[model samples]
Target chain A: MEYIKEPMEIEERSFKIITEELGDKVFEEREGKIIKRIIHTTADFEFADITVIHSDAVEAALEALNGGCRIYTDTKMALSGINKKKLTQLNCQVYCLVDDEEVAKEAKDRGITRSIVAMEKALTDKETKIFVIANAPTALFTLCQQMKVGEVKPYLVVGVPVGFVGASESKEVLLKQNVPYITVKGRKGGSTVGAAIINALMYMIE
Target chain B: MEYIKEPMEIEERSFKIITEELGDKVFEEREGKIIKRIIHTTADFEFADITVIHSDAVEAALEALNGGCRIYTDTKMALSGINKKKLTQLNCQVYCLVDDEEVAKEAKDRGITRSIVAMEKALTDKETKIFVIANAPTALFTLCQQMKVGEVKPYLVVGVPVGFVGASESKEVLLKQNVPYITVKGRKGGSTVGAAIINALMYMIE
Candidate 1:
């Protein structure tokens, strides 16, 4: 008899390889899921070492996804990485302000980053529960400042912007924020990581 | 008088910030373009330190783009980051194998990475001039291996897979390859970087 594997089976096998490789590192329920997804996305095991997930981050993100809360990302790459078809079933929509003309104009007018302006616009919607910042540290910094001033409160913040400038600094602010969050310490995060966390939560919700 | 900045102006301003931040480094004619685009894409300056570009990489990539060569990437993010509209004008198309069911099947059947199988499939087309491996070191390794065996001879290889595993090793292989290449040494790259290089070349082609 000949054996055949489907695409889904291949993906499962890939996950198995990841789990076997991860062995004994991430045993926590939520942390394990997020880490697994990150590894799956990047095929990089270093994430297991760098990723810092708030104990309640997965739960908080799951709740938001279940409640059909609006999802926002700082980069279109994150926006594109998310499984929109799956989210649509739950009546959730993903938004990215980085490419918005209005956000760009506002950023220019206020002498701020477009991501900051997009975050400001997202705050207009009280239902915005999840924030994924994957590219710009300035956006993450602005979010922390806004949260500090009680301008907005989100259920979960995925702060994973990659860079040398303010990536670590902004993530430090997120770590200090009184909110459920998932971040990679230092300067090693990208839209792929951000989307992986969200996708992991989405997969776990069902 | 009040001044209004258009979207293009804002983009220019963003580039200016990147250039100012990148100061004193990367002033070369070609290297500057690639580095600027990487900074523009990720808002990261450290890329200037990590990225290693062959002196003729940009020239080779530009030639391929002008000749309407096909672009191949390991991830969808890289595929999405590329300026498809611009590539279309040059009669070039981008290919990503990770999402293809056939490629997945081949990967499973051969017990090889899907990206590797994708690269193999891509090699079937002699016109595939540019290769971008953004998220998988295994793909880069496999490409280098195939290139060694005379299976494929891509005009330019943009090898920027980020990870603790095989990332640097595969990039080292790329560096040793007798081919025009752009790679970031060690573990500091992703789909964004891969796409930025291609987009930079596309912009330069025009």
Candidate 2:
């Protein structure tokens, strides 16, 4: 398989292998696109079981993409993982406000994380369609808290923060929120997972 | 645990938890730092078992880093994951040439990956001390092939490409090469792992 394939065939071949290995895994087809992608990105089968996608997430995300909405991420690493060319084609923009001067000042003044402030800042942009949380669980938790107050109506939330701290627990909160969200159940996610989810959704829309 | 801890304490607490959970895992303290960082980034224990580190790789990498060397990566995502502030304090520079116009043109003409061309281009950088490969097996294979002919001698190579194709097979070749290297033994690696390894090494030295 390695010798005969061209360089471009690698990604295609990886998806094929993921599908074969994920045989008997029962995610709905709509959800499978994302599950397969997260699995493809990490080469970990754990996603197949742990991933949870809201019934409306896929359709909502695609619709939001078609509308050329704003996307926000917790980290620049996650921001970079998103394909820029494809995003531009869709007229979508990605922002990471954790490094913003105002956010830093406000977060520090309030004795809160920049992640928490960043999530709050995202709500100020009414064009935001998606929130991709990767490195900071506080970002995910803040979004959930805001959602509980009916403050922001995100088209989709990709909450895949990675760490031993509040990562998994934050994801559990995201799962229970009444919003379109995609998350993994346990302590198994990161910038890679968060970006893969966004890229996967983009591929689906494309 | 989450409620009482301050934002600054999150990272420290996460590392402590990783150490506790990783109890009984046998790795020399030096090697353990890299392994644990990979695990921390992905929240997966697979790396602890699959990581391979050359005996002198860490020392050589640190020495190179202290001299303010150049680092190259296969993908920009991996490049972004590297901590810029830490890297700057050491006077280390990171480059990802996959998007270089000359590389793109040559790769298209030769029907090879930009990754292959990118690795070859790194040799032109006389100060290049380390190569971090996360997205492309071709980059790893190219480096190993270059090493065989004594064309370029890298201080350290972090090979953690992902996928189902030649990703693992390329690492197998890298393992056989007489180079100072660190790699995961299978398909379970990505940009997150590569960057985490570099960041962990930076933290270790810091």
Candidate 3:
């Protein structure tokens, strides 16, 4: 019935357990940090096998964070889960347009998911270098369409939308493209996962 | 690459697929609604097997919602994911005290997690009949401790805190108690899950 009493102690103990559970499997340090954090956040070890981080993904995200680039997430929940202390220290900004007046109106007019409109609106902001789709596959599909047409090429795409419909399929499409990205391979991701990925990258920014 | 365009269509299609994939299993209408909604939210079918709903859990929650009872969640992300329209329709309020100035000062002074302090502070509000712990095991533990001492008796406790440290352990403690609760077995739950359960119950509220 006894438990770790201190917050820092709890977190530290969690990381240690993650390491022990992971065993001696080697990981490129930067990528390992992200996957480990995701594991820490979800307590789901499957992420170690399914998480896909492009060779250049960590470096690209780090560059974007250091440049003080903006971030756009599909869900406000994702926006809330991202670490604010690090964001404040980096002087970077994160935005979620799902609640935006224009985005809501546009989606209603078009009879489409607000995710589609939100993605389009986020793309218009030139400083937005990171596109995080944690809850809506439609948003990932939109980002992919933008990338394919050469209308937008974000520095990093954290695509971890969770759903049975287009969630896994959209990430499969993202993997084949030349875009620098990080994602989970199946229907096992969410707002927390997306935020964890971005926060891990922010911590890596030096 | 073509997918469902309209938001309603996408959701409808997703629900249809979930039903198809769920196969020949039968669940009580009320329990099925919450479980299906969880599956819909996470795209993870494992919930159908892992989700635990006490017999009185749903009814207790429904009665509390009808009474315009308050909700206290451990994380802001969970607070964001809960459906506002339904909550407003029910005339209920949801609060997350992790960011409260008094909570921060108290936790810092006590050298414990804000979750523990937040749960303690929330217990002070007699209207807070539903406790949702999505991202904090310490919060669930604190609630269980209070329940053990007969200091508080919430109508329902949504304990889905996801982490490696004490997430699953705290829920185990909750399971041992006589409190009405809905939780996921093992280590598979999160803020999204917590919000999904609440929103599902809200939708089901008459």
Q: Give the candidate number with the greatest TM-score.
A: 3
Lowest summed lDDT across 10 adjacent residues in model 2 chain B is found at B1-10
TM-scores for every predicted model: 0.71, 0.95, 0.96
TM-score of 2: 0.95
Docking class of 2: medium
Tens-digit lDDT track of model 2 for B153-173: 889999999988888999898
Off by over 4 Å in 2: A1-5, A109-111, B1-5
Backbone clash pairs for candidate 2 read none
On the 0 to 100 scale, the lDDT of residue A187 in model 3 is 89
In order, what fnat does every candidate score?
0.14, 0.70, 0.79
Candidate whose lDDT is highest? 3
Report the lDDT of model 2 for residue B66.
86
Tens-place lDDT digits, model 2, residues A130-161 = 99998888888878878888988999999988
Winner on TM-score between 1 and 3 is 3
Q: Could you list the chain B TM-scores for each candidate? A: 0.93, 0.94, 0.96
